[model samples]
Target: MPETPPRARALETDTIRRLPKVLLHDHLDGGVRPGTVLELSHEQGYAALPAEDVDALSAWFAQAADSGSLARYLETFAHTVGVTQTAAALTRVARECVLDLAADGVVYAEVRYAPEQHLEGGLSLDEVVRAVNQGLREGEEEMTALAGPDRGQAAPAGPIRVRAILTAMRHAARSREIAELAVRHREAEVCGFDIAGAEDGFPPTRHLAAFEFLRQENSHFTIHAGEAFGLPSIWEAVQLCGAERLGHGIRIVDDITVDGRPVTDDLASAIARSRTEPEAFALGPLAGYVRDRRIALEMCPSSNVQTGAAPSIEKHAITLLTQLMFRVTLNTDNRLMSATSMSREAQLLVDRAGWTWTDLRRVTVNAMKSAFLPFDERLRIIEDVLKPAYDD
Candidate 1:
């Protein structure tokens, strides 16, 4: 819970953009390549595309996903989902996703997807998981080979590492099954469980049995909460369901007040006390708990603006969230939909938030610290990968 000092250099001016980063909340179905979507959709004879050409199709996705409603924003996934039903399609997309993140300078990433959605091609959950894993491994190998001798010597590591998080749709009744699947495939490819979908009515508490099962097995899980709803959803994600982290916990601001606007004190003792007391916040219990626990927020600024979570880039809460010492990590919630990259996300934070290099380093390290992986592994990424990259 210690707050780092801010620096004068902007995020783009910072050395950390070249520094390795860890991504924990990205979605596979949401990160597909538009060109791949065109080819795969054609191969499968799926006809839901807004445009046939790859370039036009890519623009079409961006335009369609720009709708403010989260539901309508999510509708673009049907085109992506339709193309990804087959194992070959899934592998290709997964591989390209890894390559894309690597190109964006991510040292480690965990991409989540619901296996049930990909079963439309008659493939079982395990098969889909293996195919995606194979794709990741293949992509990492290719990246390593392409790193070249000079860049390899300059870069202090092998190719980027990726893990898969098996997501179960919130509206579906298969949470327990998916939780078991995640635990069952822990060594193979699966690293954790997540419940992704609309967050308004389909709260995390609906999957108590699954969360309980995961807790019993000592498995890691992050809940998609507070993106489209208010503090109630975030409260349940943590208090009722025991989520280790909240994906896009943007709505926690609804509880705070800063200069008559929403902003929690960066270092308030009362807010800090809520880490364990759970009910100590005079402003909002949810905000206090999140702040005290040091729970990381996987914030995707561009996607938030596109979905109307915020009105614009400059006015986004992420700027204030970082300043408040919240454990905030920049992420690409849906790369295809937002037409974004992790580097682009960082650059946008710099351009709009006036974040310094130190700010970028601090947030990236916060992400490494908050990763669902074990502590030692996360530390290794921070000390071995991130530190060297930024220091150089």
Candidate 2:
């Protein structure tokens, strides 16, 4: 594997690998290191793994994810989920994920995990949240110490500052309860709430009570929408449920059209124009609403392809969406399952999507801008952390 250089400025294929990124949709359990899986599974005596060696186990996971079957792709998580039943395992995995993102040039990240899933080993939800928070604090402190006092003139800042988002599985029946749980920990590591699961059969409307509660309490939340599903899911999440962001919102492509054909080409062209003009096309009702409302899209390329949300990398809506200034953000969604890093995700867009240094900086900044933090803190991160680093 090639190494990213220190203090990269321009967005070359290699530069994208070193440029700072902000991720908002990565899953904690889904991003566990394969070696950690092997170690934890061995310790717990989980009977689900086919490979004992770490390298072989990672290879197996990659193969399974590439199999184009969501069920088979999900089976890779059996070991990760099995091992993550205890507080110690959850904390270690969470810490390692932050370290991994930092090494991959992710300057900021929000890792989401369902607390209910980790409580199977006899810990309470609050205990699981605390354990994860402890890991995040450790990772941030370590990374900050290693960052030093800025490398004089060349480099501007450090690697990553991570937060946790508590996710409610869509198939589960604890939406309101999870919503309350997320709100209870806003000042802690819990930054926001999310609902994630199979998007086709389950929609955000199913969690109306949860969304309503969050809305009433002024709590932030993003909904998994329009990934494996279509416009209906996006509609429910944004129009009906009031989602702050749309996770893997690739299916917003359904509402766009080009030359009388229901496709993303002209939309892509329109997006390409917006990079320079910003007033190239008239937005349809759906596009207009999403754009006007500034609903961020947590787009993940590899995960999109793996989950059958996108046919190919080049055809992904990230290109068009960013060009159109849709407040697009690059994300991992699942680092382990996708066999990807934040750097690799940005590198792919630069390689296949024709993104430039300005493009990389702007997209990353877009992500930071849409983060579910207080205005002052978000501004501090952007002006103090992101701007100085990339402006060079």
Candidate 3:
């Protein structure tokens, strides 16, 4: 093998961690710190955790979720969601999530959680949203203060802004209610709505009422599609439900081909062939629609690998999607479960997939563009914060 070219070489770990990032698909219940889970479980008197000690519990979550089945990977959320059932627990988890992301150099994030999952503590859905919002606000203030007088331009760590995307479990029946809740709090830190769960049987069409309501009210939403399922799910999400973005849309590769042959199983070969002969690759109608419309694919490499959506970082469809300019954005779907952060995801692509600084910067810009934020705010962050920071 030949030595790697300098331009394509991976950036240093510390340098990657210091670069600013934007995250669009992160889960609140999926990212609770193990220590927080233990403490909260103790405080709430819930003892169903698989492990008692912090380290053991952390390892358990990572291991349990590493199973190469999406259904099995979702089982790890029980302990995390089990512990955070009250306002205080939810608030603490949300605040810590922001701080952790800030430390990992995520300047902007839209953290999501199913509101119905946290209501078992007897709190109403409204209260659940309020508790999480309170925590997000507190975290934002703390990050801002940490940035000090210069507003983080001169500091080692910069300020972070975290917004909420209210999620409704797709298997449940409260999607319309959750959509209404999200629209109600749209001005109070809640940025959007989503439906997430196993996507096999519970199709996006099942929640048609909720999507229709959101669109009628002029609210933004994304659908969890094309991860465990295939193109039909994505077709319904885009054509039927009007999803603003796709949550883990890696399976869209099922609709792509190279030289008239499907590239689902032989993605690495297809990618290599495309590099030498770009004209050999072709996108089917659904893929063309998604790409032409710039529907952002919130691709989480490690999480997708753990759930067997992709083989590995090097062979992940994200690299091919990025090469094809498919409006791809990097994300850490579950920080605790995947043992990953924004920086870690970027570093993996750089090291395993030979992505460069330009690649990282492009994805970051793509995320900001696809963000549910108002146009001016998105432009301000991209022009003022993201561009300046990446330029350095």
Best prediction by lDDT = 3
Clashing pairs in 1: 258-261
Candidate 2 lDDT by residue in tens digits, 1-392: 65333345456555555556788989898899988998898888887888889888888877788866655676777678889998889889988988888777778889999998887789998898999999898888888877866633344246577888888989899989989999898888688899988777888899999999998989889999888788889999999999989998887867765544555655455545556765544566787789788899999999888867776677778877777678888888888888898878877877777777777787789898899888888888888877865775
The lDDT per prediction is 0.81, 0.81, 0.90
- What TM-score does structure 3 among the candidates reach? 0.95
Query: Global lDDT for candidate 1?
Result: 0.81
Model 2: pairs clashing at backbone N, Cα or C within 3 Å:
none
Q: How many angstroms is residue 134 displaced in model 3 relative to the true structure, after the best TM-score fit?
A: 0.5
Clashes of 2: 0
* Top of the candidates by TM-score: 3
lDDT tens digits, residues 63-105, model 3? 9999999999998998899988999999999999999998888
What is the lDDT, from 0 to 100, of the residue 97 in candidate 2? Answer: 87
* Candidate 2 TM-score, C-alpha based: 0.91
**Candidate 2 Cα misplacement greater than 4 A, ranges:** 1-10, 149-159, 264-282
The superposed Cα distance between candidate 3 and the true structure at residue 329, in angstroms, equals 0.3
Give the better candidate number (1 or 2) by TM-score: 2
